[model samples]
Target chain A: PNADAYGAARERLRNQARPAGSLGILEEVGARLAGIFGTIDVRLDRKIVITCAGDHGICAEGVSRFPQKVTPQMVYNFVGGGASVSVLARHAGAEVRVADLGVDWDFAPDLPIYHKKVRKGTANFAAVPAMTREEAVRSIEAGIEIVDELTAEGPVHLIGTGDMGIGNTSPSTAIIAAYSNIPVPELTGRGTGIDDDGLRKKIAAIEKGLALHRPDPKDPVGVLEKVGGLEIGGLAGLVIGAAAHGIPVVCDGLIATAGALIACELAPSARPYLFAGHNSVEVGHRYMLEHLGLQPLLHLEFRLGEGTGAALAMTLMDAATRILAEIKTFAEVGINDAQ
Target chain B: PNADAYGAARERLRNQARPAGSLGILEEVGARLAGIFGTIDVRLDRKIVITCAGDHGICAEGVSRFPQKVTPQMVYNFVGGGASVSVLARHAGAEVRVADLGVDWDFAPDLPIYHKKVRKGTANFAAVPAMTREEAVRSIEAGIEIVDELTAEGPVHLIGTGDMGIGNTSPSTAIIAAYSNIPVPELTGRGTGIDDDGLRKKIAAIEKGLALHRPDPKDPVGVLEKVGGLEIGGLAGLVIGAAAHGIPVVCDGLIATAGALIACELAPSARPYLFAGHNSVEVGHRYMLEHLGLQPLLHLEFRLGEGTGAALAMTLMDAATRILAEIKTFAEVGINDAQ
Candidate 1:
């Protein structure tokens, strides 16, 4: 299986002449790929970041602290290059494309919007399922179509998934609990700095959805249709698509973590392709990371949810790859040390 | 007179339209110059880093954990692009030039070594004064001449000072206490991860030197000649030279701190040109920072020398300059806001 390829790659990278485990989590990334590809000569140059933007009907219930108008404001901020992710992408030298999967507002026809909205946003999942089964598959296929287009450009070395949706974390937490098999309390977090009372309300909403759709863990796509947001379902599709195509993907904070867990449940080998960027201050983040058996690199108490963490983590990846490819061997440098 | 310019510049940078105290110590760097140049439109394109290397005769007394050979080995590491400061300079887009002011070993003729040795390092400053008055002046003048040549290429915006000398901390501690009018114990620190017992011995050595010199703090150069290492004297000259030419200089950890204290004593205006990089983990670092009335930005418990800290701090300067120069005005963006 693909897991064997990742295991081999990790062994080869670790066996290279250096201090053992000196590279830390970077070594895990390289090893994971080596096992995925079944070869030691792995390369990571082409980077593609997919940002999914949607709107939540829960906003109508006054669940979020920020006005729903701020969603479009931030989308414009992304376009105007003022968002944190914009600077981070510039720092990482990665190409980014934004998609509007289910935003309530309309964007220009020529603005790279995917136009994959399923009813202009989800129905409040606390009240009912966000989308029907067929609609979830359609959104996921939209993400798959984007990956197919990106793969045509070149060998897609890495994929990063980011989401922008007001109140989407509510659905994401529900989907994570359904797939991760953790209790709703363990999977819920203070999304967007919600107050203690708001957190309690959010947890209650997730538990209500869990009661309505008792999803089977064995069928992740079925579970996603039962509870996940359109963006989360789309991200899950992207992860599975990248792994099926043998491309590595780095997952950003909590929302992306939920997507990865769903992808892994769908195809166990998909776990080999994913790297967790950082642990967010979100309470659900620890449960997600633990479920995935992942250890993130930086822990600076960051809770920003714009894929900024993934972009910063990419810098460390660049450093790791440069060191792996560029450092001279002992024989090449005339050093007498034994490997 | 120069100190007045520094104070004025510090005020203007603080008044820029942004979050109050958001840019941290970088605000002071900009403001210090606003006072001097009478404008916030400042430039920092050309940078010069002076690395002064010597050998401490106290190395012969087994005071340091690293061998005296490490002094030259690190010099080679700097030249070979393997040292931490080398990578940091490349990151900061700054130019680095090394000066072999004094080392016991003679290097190859074409090795880019600056022939400014002061009697193959110094007599054990623990046992005697490190250098004579004539030798100290010669070393300082050599540094001045180097900066003059470097500034001829362009308008030097920033200057940085670093050094390489084993057992140099003994002399540095003596200089810091004598100049700051602090007790020897208050000014001593583990220079390079020295043990608790070793630190006690270092403080004893500094106390002994203070007893021998009893230097007059008013006569900065005389104080330097009596207690300073060759590298420290050279750095003091570089600081003064950069200020005499109206270029801002960033002072590194402890050794550079000693040099800045000397520069301020010699030409009070030069304090405006000096930016302290970080509060190093050395026990004396906080004292040096307090004496200079500076607040360092980054605090990662770094004690490594070789100007690495200063090089990293330069990145923040780049960020600050970009914020000042590149961020759009509310009026320009057509946003109505109270300024």
Candidate 2:
């Protein structure tokens, strides 16, 4: 990050025709964007939320409220532009790119989605590793490839991470447990609103998976191979790929931030590129964002995932860029500064 | 608010394709809108932020970082659509109506703004009541009249409160001190980034103003006459008027919420009409919103009191309405709900 450029942006904002720092965090966010882009002016005209869809093998453990088949169904919804992410992304003037990461389904050549399936589905982590380390690497590499392909059309100003997979949060909780000292119960939540019995089952399943795999926190790839889903790996790759290209990325809810965890671990420099789209009701999400040292842009008690929060925040980022680049300075407007 | 209609809206949302209560607080907010409108389906087409601009007597207390003249200057900016509120309210698809309530300057008659000035300015609150009770009553009634005139074109679906007055936080802190038991120091913050010395002076000024007037907590009108700005009274009237018409109102920040406190106290029914736009960094705002039992829509650390945050939240409320009103239910989509 360009500290000098960040300071310059903040100085320019301070000279705007308003009370000093009255814009509050929006000013700081704009300044940070300036530093990230290495310029005083930033523009976010081209925005997109890349949602990766995969199936969790943990469904075999009865950890999810929805059936695993719902994964492919939601992908169909995304392709039809009928999902929450699609609606919100459109509202934010952002496009949605659906990635078929590992949804236990095959598609025809005419499908309106990205074809990057790593496997049919992860192995049921309650009994075995979700995928081999090579598969984990491949899943994330798919994400990097997708990002590069998308940016080739033009400069993708901002990207948000999204996911649509049933039973995904079970693995996300397990990933948080491996990386942080937070307990499984403290990290677990009723993903998509499960009843009490399902919650108990999910807690038990995660404890079993953790005990069996004993994944290493330091080895993010190993953790992904052991307990993470393929879409999670892909989402992580999206973050790393965006960082490698010097583009800022936003991640939505617990599912997306779980991928952020892997990406940051794999490439610690990705920290500066990642933005927490919103704080989810999921208990582990707070720990994940805190561990990553990210303050989410929104806190709406959201847990539906699908990059909805990230898409909503993209609009604010665009507004922030406008505030930084469009507003007249005190010198330009001949307005006196605060005495 | 119609509890029956609120329950009906919740039921309708529960039947949506997504899981029950997936939208979280947004679902509740939309349901409240439904109850306020006495319908299961609510539409927020005509939206506006009625910003009351005025001068504060507390300017004589040296409690602010900016000059009192900035009040009218910023109002000019509002008319030019160059202020933050104008930009954000436009972005949120809400109209901005600036009402001059004791602004200490006379706008040209042809200027596109509301002429509701209660007085040239209030008496200096450091040594006397900010306004006579009659002036206070007139200022608030002006707000009510504006709401009626604005909605006369058509029913306004949502109304937001905004204020532009230098050193207005002094009277706001005094209002909280009168009603709440929270100590002034704990509830006081440096509004608009005052230095340590300015913050001290603001606290001392509030303490002195409170001791001098001894404003009765039970008589909200008396409290406004003693310590509130004319624009604050106007904002309070906006809330009461919105409730009288069964419309939901969003309040910007500290100054706006100070008005909300008075409105809710005067007519407890207005509680249902009030939505916190965002929690201000101003310490007194916490007690004000808590006293109103209102949860803010955003927590952007925004302290620029121009209905900017309320404008931003208007977009979210629109999104929430879309989510509740759009999106195919599971049966319509032929998708299975959680098992």
Top TM-score model: 2
lDDT for each residue of candidate 1 in A22-42, tens digit (9 for 90 to 100): 334555665565565565455
TM-score of each: 0.66, 0.96
A1-339: candidate 2 lDDT, tens digit per residue: 789989999988888777777777678778889989998778788898999999988998888777888888888888877777877888788999999999998877588888999999999999999999999999999999998998888999899999999999999999999989777988899999888998999999999999999999989999999999999999999999999988999999888999999999999998888888888999999999889998888878888888889998887787677677766665665566544
**Any runs in candidate 2 off by more than 4 Å, and if so which?**
A1-5, B1-5, B37-43
User: lDDT of candidate 1 vs native?
Assistant: 0.68
True contacts kept of each: 0.00, 0.51
lDDT of 2 by residue, B1-339 (tens): 888988888887887666677767788888888888888667788999988988987888888888888888888888877778877887788899899998998789888888999998888887999999999999889988988888788889999899999888888888998989677899898888788998888888888888898899999999999988899999999999998888899998999999889888888978878898888888889888888888888888888888888988898888777676666567656686543
Which run of 10 residues does model 2 chain A get worst, by summed lDDT?
A: A330-339
**Tens digit per residue, CA lDDT, model 1, B193-225:** 567877777777778777887878888788777
Model 2 CA lDDT for position A70: 86
